[model samples]
Target: MNGRISLRGLRAKGHHGVYDFERADGQDFVVDVVLELDLSRAAVSDDVADTVHYGELATALVGVLTGEPVNLIETLADRLLTVCLADERVETAEVTVHKPQAPIPHDFADVAVTLRRSRL
Candidate 1:
């Protein structure tokens, strides 16, 4: 359960925000995901089937990132976590959604939401 797999700086376009312009034109959303799971089986067998595949995981996460438009990054992060935890092998999932081009007028390096969930 302590073993971790992470994907960082995943960029996708999504129409997600409270602003009408945001939903109309869309903006870039960046995501980072960390999945916790047991890797012993894969280590012992050297078989991919025993572990989570990074390529497939990326595609799935991207699907969630671009699939629907939500009003909040919190909602997007929650959905992204769901995608990460869909694999039974994952015991815990941590997701961060970055909205770099957020509607704020002030100068900011980044705006993000981080959420973590553990399997029941």
Candidate 2:
């Protein structure tokens, strides 16, 4: 429960936005994920089976990012949390969804939404 797994800058193209052109042309989305769990077993055993496989998690999330066309990043973050929490090893999962090319009237660096889920 004291260990952490952080996956950052996971970029993928997605067609999710309020504007019609955004959904039509698509844009890059950045994701950051953090998993809280106990890594003592994997630390001592040096086996992947003792812990969650982040690669598989990333692949699954990428599939979701490329598959659906959600209207908001908040919804997407919730969806990503669902995937992150699917791993039994993860006691708590945090998902951050970033939209860099949002339709803002003024110049801005990025927009993002973060959500956290915990297993009881």
Candidate 3:
């Protein structure tokens, strides 16, 4: 049985941009992570030990997202994917990083980067 865990609209402030102003001032970033895994053991055992803790995953992602300055969202997405895949139970991860207040002059909703990774 495949199970999925999703974390959405995680807010954080970080220095990730090409321009000095963008890097210096920082901005709000939203992260969405989806993890795919087999949960048959957890379901049958009825024990938290048999499954991945979502809080731990969120904390790990926060550490990487806020740890240092990243040049691009692509790099950030890659880092997030690595962090998610670190878990032995996770077979696949889909990460999306959203930057709401970008430096673009024109009207736009937001800028985002999405990446999908598998443990093959």
Collision pairs in model 1: none
- Candidates' C-alpha lDDT: 0.92, 0.91, 0.90
For candidate 1, what's the RMSD?
Answer: 1.1
Candidate 1 lDDT by residue in tens digits, 1-120: 358898999999989999999999999999999988999899889989999998999999888878889999999999999889889989999999999999998999999999999976
lDDT of 3 by residue, 1-120 (tens): 999989998888888888999788988889999999999999999988888888888888888877798889999999999999998899999999998988889999879999999987
Query: Per-prediction TM-score, please?
Result: 0.96, 0.95, 0.95
Cα displacement (Å) at residue 47, model 2: 0.6
Tens-place lDDT digits, model 2, residues 36-72: 9999999999999999888998899998898779889
Candidate 3 off by > 4 Å: none
After the best TM-score superposition of candidate 2, give how far the Cα of residue 61 lies from its true spot, in angstroms: 1.0
Off by over 4 Å in 2: none
